[model samples]
Target: MHSIAFRLVAEEEEGRLMAQRVERRKLRDTINPFELPQSLFEKYYRLNKPGFQYLLDVLTANTEAPKKAFAISPIAKLSACLRFLAEGGYQTGVGKDCDVSNKESCM
Candidate 1:
């Protein structure tokens, strides 16, 4: 009976340690220079992506939940569009997805 109690406590402690590790990784990943939003980045336009991903991770994780109409800054939108163009896919797909206004040049 005592052994069971000790095991339970140890297991709980182990879980806590694992959670800490995960948080640390999350924090480290966010600090990277180019982190972009995952929802935005996953659309395959990710060039110089790691840094964008890290920034997005940090921003989103640190902030309050956004509204459905969440808007990215214009510069980021342009950058994302450019990345899409360089990668040979239309920004329209990502734009339609995020419900963003399609830039005329993307088509």
Candidate 2:
């Protein structure tokens, strides 16, 4: 009888611990309350798009006079990508499951 009661208590403790573990995992999936603003994502896309478009514009701007703007026209896309890479492009190893280096080249 005593052994049965001890086993029941142990089983209840195990069940409670399992429930806490599940709750912790759910909380882990939640976003941090002190994270960056959502507006930042909008700005990030906007900034990259314009810079990327500008780079393409210059690239296809003129086939006739490649020598004219051949050197550099003060664009932003390549620079931005390079800059982002330099500034740690898409971190993943520490905690994330995806990083830019794993999928995309810096250039």
Most TM-score-accurate candidate? 2
TM-scores for all candidates?
0.31, 0.32
User: What is the total number of backbone clashes in candidate 2?
Assistant: 0
Candidate 1: residue pairs that collide: 34-51, 34-52, 35-51, 35-52, 35-53, 35-54, 35-55, 36-52, 36-53
lDDT of 1 by residue, 1-107 (tens): 99999999999999999999876544333322134356655554544566555665666676766455434443354455555775677655544432332323325
In order, how many clashes per candidate? 9, 0
State candidate 2's TM-score: 0.32
Rate residue 6 of model 1 by lDDT: 100
